[model samples]
Target: MSTLEIRDLHVSVDTETGPKEILRGVDLTVSSGQTHAIMGPNGSGKSTLAYSLAGHPKYTVTSGTVTLDGEDVLAMSVDERARAGLFLAMQYPVEVPGVSVSNFLRTAKTAVDGESPKLRTWVKDVKNSMQSLAIDDAFAERDLNTGFSGGEKKRHEILQLELLKPKFAVLDETDSGLDIDALRVVSDGVNRFTADGDKGVMLITHYTRILRYIKPDHVHVFIAGRVAEEGGPELADKLEEHGYVDYAGASA
Candidate 1:
């Protein structure tokens, strides 16, 4: 089984004044067949940790080590990270004006696998995935995320997750804007991806709503860029009842 390890990770971002530190010494490990839920208040470095792992240029790793199966993840470029089996589903997916969803998915799959998928099987797979996600057939012909609703964008992200089948996925606030119905659809998609017990997930969210649909093996409470508590699914139930107030004050 593959493992993704983050050790004493410290990241920062440049601002108007200067470099502002975000993640201050955080550590976590996710192995295959495990799902870890990261819960925290706003500005607690949840997204920073996600982006840092995906090798976003905006966030700089000042000090830390991120390894995938013992290979240095921090050393690889963004695309190289994808090829290494890491995927990130952004909270707010950006629009790609000129790229059609069909073309985009095919291109990404080719890049990740180092070879193009056969036309016949690729077409059938894309069609089946889209139908399962309740996505319209015409969506494949539409430009990626252009004029798409929040739910549409999020669904498309999961579509990629389904097709590419990454070793680990960092889902950053994927449930933020989805309604109850859309939420169920999206959550089901994630469940299908992990049902095989071979994929790992780092689900970042502010609420326990999604956790109801996607059960995590471990729950971590992030306070001030550090994990304040770790437990089983019971921890999520506590968060729902007590919220992060107690943890916030302690971290202060």
Candidate 2:
């Protein structure tokens, strides 16, 4: 089984004011077939953690290490990290006006897997993934994320997740701005990806509604850029009931 491990990870982003620290000694581990949820208030560095793990250049690793399936992820380039089985679904997927969804997906798959899939087979796979995600086949011919709704963008992310089939996935705020129907569709795609025995997931979300669909195996509460609480499925329930007030105050 694959695993992603983070040990005392500190991240900084360069700003005009100088280097600004975002993630403060964050540690997390996710193993194959399991789902972990990270819950935090705004500005707690949740997105920073996701971007750093994905080897984004803007987020520098000031200290600590990230490993995927026992390989050093921090040392790998962003493309190499992706080839090594690391995937990050961003909160805001950038729009590429001239890039059609089908073409973008093909290029991404070729880049990550180091070879192009046969055209006929690849089209079939894309069709199946879109159908599974409840997305219309016509959407594949449209430009990537151009004028798409937030829910549609998030589902498109999951579409990549299914098609790419990475060993470890970090989903950052994927549930944001999704209505109940869209949430179910996105969650179904995630569930399909991890339902097997060799993929792991780290879902970063602010709301518990998505958890109802994915059913995380563990939950961690991020307070002031640190994990202040961790537990089983019940933790998500508690957060839904009382919100992050108590945990947010604990790390103050």
Top candidate by TM-score: 1
What tens digits encode model 1's per-residue C-alpha lDDT throughout 1-252?
999999999999999999999888999999999999999999999999999999889999999899999999999999999999999999989899999999999999999999999999999999999999999999999999999999999999999999999999999999999999999999999999999999999999999999999999999989888888999999999999999878847565
TM-score of candidate 1 to 2 decimals: 0.99
Q: 15-46 in candidate 2: lDDT tens per residue?
A: 99999888888889999999999998888888
Which clashing pairs does model 2 show? none
Winning candidate number (lDDT):
1
Cα RMSD of all models vs. native, in order, equals 0.8, 1.2
lDDT of each: 0.95, 0.91
Alpha-carbon deviation at 212 in model 1, angstroms:
0.7
